[model samples]
Target chain A: MVVNSSAELTDDEVDRIFRALADATRRDIVRRTLAGEASVSELAGAYSMSFAAVQKHVAVLEGAGLVTKRPRGRERVVRGNPDAIRRAQRLLDAYEQIWVARIGRLDALLDDTPPQQ
Target chain B: MVVNSSAELTDDEVDRIFRALADATRRDIVRRTLAGEASVSELAGAYSMSFAAVQKHVAVLEGAGLVTKRPRGRERVVRGNPDAIRRAQRLLDAYEQIWVARIGRLDALLDDTPPQQ
Candidate 1:
């Protein structure tokens, strides 16, 4: 019944993931967290924006499953989720395949025809 | 000078590609065109929206390099471009690699430590 079993996240899921990634601030958060888990304050310090803005970005990333927050003492540390990124990559790969198949069909059609005047 | 040579579209390029893909109508346009080249009217017939709206979506796809419009008599036939899709896929692949490397570092850190009580 399911068309794609691998990384077949629903459109809603893709929307959430992509929307979260749409912002440069959130992207920077993902990139920084990828280096290692960091507390909210630590991430806030790197940006010129308000701490609340950075917090909101982190929340968006968490909602998209791109980042996971764990409690450490009084702080919460956020870590990047590789599986989620892999799922997003798989979706893009599917789109790539669709285009490839289209090209293949055109090639077949061209091959079937004789030299044109 | 370039950080990523593999499908390394600039931020502006990514913004355009993702913005073009952000719409459901444009996504449908890409999907339909992937099946085969279609005239604007033919593509318009499948959707409830106006032909002009469909044409706009087609234009967006063309701008994103996802579709190529070729003149055929009075009608322009739109064909999908596999190379652009591949380029986009490579960008997503690079993001996936970033997350994977992040996880690898975490695993390495954990391996260095003994079981905690």
Candidate 2:
């Protein structure tokens, strides 16, 4: 099966995900919701910022697929998406592997391994 | 020993790192440099943007510790730091683990595991 994983996040999706997470409040919101789901009102109460501001942050995260919102009575419950976190993590992992492979090739060239013609 | 790891990144540092990585141009610069080091001028030539634009991107990445710049004769060489990538990855990993642990607790509650007194 062609699994759609964070491993296959597009450049645009990657950009949105990182941008959404650049703020401290947003990161805290994610952490809190990840541990336990909460309504927008609950999240807003935890911050000194306005409810609209917290709602806006949630909107950005929702757009990035970092969190999902579902109707719970009159409130929208927010829950963190582990897959989205995994996706961003996978991108960084890929970059680390790239650096490692480059170093490995350089090490081989300095050793007994023959350089490609 | 007082070892400063990405695992201990402050909120401000996390903010900077994620902000620096939110752009496609910046991400590309990171990927290219990770494969091999390149000077700011060389990077400018590869992109259609002005040299100043590319320089700004490099500066952002440098400030976030995502990349490092060093004097190399008339040019400055830019190289991606794998540790920075690891730091951000670790943060994401922590978030994933938080979600996993929450689910684990929920699963235990449904099973024969006794709830905390």
Candidate 3:
């Protein structure tokens, strides 16, 4: 099957995903949420920043589709979206793959020709 | 061998790498350089932006260690650094790994527990 994965993220989505991940606090939030879900207040408590700041960070992550917030009674639970993480991973993988392929081609060319000396 | 890979990127490097990747034009430049080295002028020719704007983008990528420039005669050839891309990839992999592990534990818990009536 032709799987449509993070490998297919548009340029805009790539921008959003990378931009969302650009902050240390945001990346940490992602790491925490991936292990388990947390409320915005709970996440805020773990950081030195104000609750409003944490909320804004969550907002950016959510905007990038990196995390999702669901209402649970009185609190909003934030959970990391693994698919989004994988999508970003795939883009980085593409860059790595291109580099690896180029190296392979260069290696092949070196092997095909005799020593220049 | 205890291969220390991109897995070793500090929070600061992660921030820079992702921030550098956040721009579509910068990413395209990375892609171009990965295939083969290109002069800044060559890259600028492909975009509608001014030469100075492209130079600024290249500087960002260089500062992030995503690309490097070396003087080849009068022009500086910009080339993608695969190791840096791998570093960013490893960081993303860590996020994905945590999510997968969480899912694994969830699955195990579901299996261990009896069905709810």
Candidate 4:
């Protein structure tokens, strides 16, 4: 699925991505799937949870665009989507820029420098 | 306050940070405060919402370690915390690595390469 658009993401999209990532198990699933596509059963075998639970986690990752699943011979092979991750990184980077600018202002104030006119 | 802990953050802490960032208004508040420290009243004046609402947003940001508030005269001046943002970036970077590794494995498989022995 096309996860990226030129416009910024909505709040809900960001919420979904972060929420999907909040769980350590889901994060591990993403990590494993990124290495290569794997069947739901294959992934379930590695986890301590039931197959249903792993499937649900995969669904959450899929919804967040973090993982994409394709049917293959009565099984669904899941793959991680790197572009979605890059987009998330971009969002964090923007916030970092804002944060750095704020720190710079504080430094100037502490140094008793006049505002640039 | 020291936001960084050598230990990894707990699930609840991650929840608080993401929840605080889920609102556009709160995100904008972070952006503005990052530019420079500002009194609650000064920030509230810029938004159409009630002062209480803005105050609550500041509280959430502060809880997330995204912003820090210090008393100044009879007011509190809020400043953005860049280190928190950096830590968050680190988390996302780790995810990106996992996603990339998964993709590499898939690519190798697609080329009909045998499993690395």
Per-candidate TM-score against the hidden true structure = 0.77, 0.91, 0.89, 0.75
Tens digit of lDDT per residue, candidate 1, span B22-43?
5667777777777777999999
Q: How close is chain A of candidate 1 to the true chain A, as a TM-score?
A: 0.88
Model 1 Cα displacement at B8 (Å)? 3.5
Q: DockQ for every model, please.
A: 0.44, 0.84, 0.82, 0.50
Which pairs of residues have clashing backbones in candidate 4? A34-B102, A34-B103, A35-B102, A102-B34
Q: What residue pairs clash in candidate 1, if any at all?
A: none
Query: Candidate 4 docking: what grade?
Result: medium
Compute the DockQ of candidate 4: 0.50
**Residues A23-114, model 2: lDDT tens digits:** 99999999999999999999999999999999999999998888989998899999998888888887888899999999998988789767
What value of lDDT does candidate 3 attain over all alpha carbons? 0.89
lDDT of 4 by residue, A12-90 (tens): 7877776777677887787787766789999999999999999999999899888999999899999887777777778
Ranking by DockQ: 2, 3, 4, 1
- What RMSD value applies to candidate 1? 4.8
Candidate 4 deviant stretches above 4 angstroms: A5-7, A44-53, A102-117, B5-7, B46-50, B102-117
What is the C-alpha lDDT profile of model 1 across A1-117, one tens digit per residue?
112336456776676676666566777788778767899999999999999989999998898888889999999999877677677667667766776787798899999999989
Q: Model 4, retained fraction of real contacts? A: 0.64
**Model 2 segments beyond 4 Å from truth?**
A1-7, A113-117, B1-3, B113-117
- Let me know the DockQ for model 2: 0.84
CAPRI classification of candidate 3: high
